[model samples]
Target: MGSVIEREHSATGSMALGQWAVIGMCMLFNMINGLDTLATAFVLSSLSAEWALNGFQQGILLSASLIGMASGSTFAAPMADRHGRRPLLLASLLLSGTTMLLSFWAQGPWSLALLRALTGIGVGATLVGANVLTYEHASLRRRGLAISLQSVAFALGVSLGGLLAHALNETVGWRYVFLAGGSFTLAAGLTGALWLRESFEFLAVKSLPAQQADHRPALSNVATNSPVPSLASQRLFGRGYRQHFSTRQWRETISLATAFFLVMFCFYFVVSWTPTLLVQTGASETHGIKGGMLLNTGGMLGALLLGLGANRYGSRQLLLGFLLLNAVLMTLMVPATQVLSLAIGMGFTLGLLLNGAIAGLYILAPQIYGTGERASGVGLVLGLGRLGSILSPVVAGVLLDAHWSSQALFTFYASSLLLAALAIAWGRGGTEERAGRSRN
Candidate 1:
């Protein structure tokens, strides 16, 4: 009886620790992955003024990173399945940190763009690795919840970048902002190295079921739907996944990718170019930047609340509500800028609704595919989404180049969210399959 009780207690402890480790590590990685990237955007005005860059040039600089992200995201998932999650994630984090440090050495727009591209590559790799690992680590009962927490990390990192850039730009210089963010990534990576263990599922891929049957009896019950392939070729493009790479899958990928693309285009446009937009609207640099940073804070709030809420109520409804709310708040941003409180409130609400809803898309993408094709399915979705993000800056720059009114810009943003809502609403026809392996 004592032995049974002790075994039960050990099992409970392991379960709790696994949940915390997976969620907490992924969140921290999310924070590090985007911190320097976001800070660069906040400091772009200063860089432009220092270098005499036009709006189009600035947009090109922004596009450089997305270009790398698009490429990197395409390959990251396959490598994660091919090798394993932890090593690749660690490498991505290291690359992100190193690339951030290199940004300090950039002398002009072209150089900065090159460095930014490298940073984007690192972010793409990290994102793919992080999401796949989080899904592998989480209990089936709470997989959605674990995945959504990554959105919280994204908001936190963005907010931190904005605040840090705003606070330090006046005193330490914009380069210092990159350095600080980079240092944080290095530190976080080191901590992760010490604490993070390989996911049990990844280990299971290498072990025979019979060999795992004695002391590791728990491994015997791993769900077949979880795709425990020992080889990458067996999992991604395997016989079981031929349908996933077929015409039907391509159609689904395109539809969802386009909707996600629209959403991200709006999101990145607001995030990457908002400071420029606000400054163009006759707000002083200080007020414009302060307002821009507020959006990230709002994003963090929305992601945390809606992400957890979706776990209870369902991702579909949460996504619809958040997108509709985003449309409403974005429409208000044009007039609300006249009042400080109202403008900040609108920015916050917009961030929360927009990012939180997008987070659900990330969770849903993997679910839409069978276990055998999970990595490829997610990679394609995010790759297409990055293309949307890539185009956002150019589109916004064109509007600004043509002297579009702030109201007009905001209107475009609002309409995009509405379009995204319509797409999601009309395209909700798929069945979801459970992943095969549980993290524990």
Candidate 2:
């Protein structure tokens, strides 16, 4: 029995070369996903000028990819559970890149919107797949840090894309930006195909218990000791899948999904509208671009800080504090906008806290489910959360069209943050109670 346990430990030992390779590839994938996701924002002013788009039309264009993202996260990303993370990730990269390239030839708003939506499908799937891969590859001790680093990579991509757009929009035109992003995505896809491996935990779960019987003694020992539930016994789908989860599991998923939805509502509104909002408030188009970059810059910093502190301070406590602070900062944004420097500074700080809240979610998400359900669990949360993204731009645009002040719009967004904080607080309480019961 002791020998069997030793073999099991060896077989399931710490992350190795393949795991590191997956982490590096996931980082690159997330960076490209970020670039593609935010590229529209960087080019929105230029695209509007060229296409002669109205506020409503522009809102549709901004929301188009987000709609696609929601669809992909809901429907396409879940396929990773059945087919394999690598295939879905590679396919998403290819599809998104091809569609984004096609966007450069768009003749009007309708064509561009269609292309953007298609690109978003790829971006959304890649986001989910890459995250699952990252989660599975890291050692249990470092998983939170790995996920947070991925967010940092994504944040850098957003900032870099904005800086690139600001530099090239006047000289090369917006079409070139699409061309560049598409080319990079295609290249990254090739790299991923060549280097990325499927998750080992995924493989272990898919293996039949009979086939893994030799390791059962060790596995049983692990089940008794580890916090992570054993996935070897769970079915991959259907009634068996439903039977796998208890009421507490379902409640945890629902709570996380709700918090994710509320936070994303606020996040997408800022990412999709901050530049345009700045322009509307009398800033130059260049200042608008700079504002977007500053926002993402703060996000990178926020993610870094969270990664460093999350293990020591506790993720839930940090998340709750970040959300409340973000609420305050966003409310203060109203007055800050009256001064250009102050507004830019506040945008950075708001982005930091906003992304800190998001990073907190990313840290907590993987802890809630085992390998068998991790992809689907994270995908569902993200897909549902994207409803906020899909709705915010269009709704905010209509309100702006009706002559709502920028201050009023921000105040409304701040309110969403408060609601999100409440959701997280509730989730924390439930999780703690569940942990206590499990311990007793």
Report clashes for each candidate as comma-separated counts. Answer: 2, 0
Write the residue-wise lDDT of candidate 2 on 234-300 in tens digits: 3454333352246647666667778888888889788767777778778899898789778888899
The CA lDDT of each predicted structure is 0.69, 0.77
Write the residue-wise lDDT of candidate 1 on 37-148 in tens digits.
Answer: 5666778878888899997788778677778777677765556655667887888788888888888878888988888888887788778778877766665556667787
Give candidate 2's TM-score: 0.85
User: All candidates' TM-scores?
Assistant: 0.81, 0.85
Model 1, backbone clash pairs (residues 3+ apart or across chains), number: 2
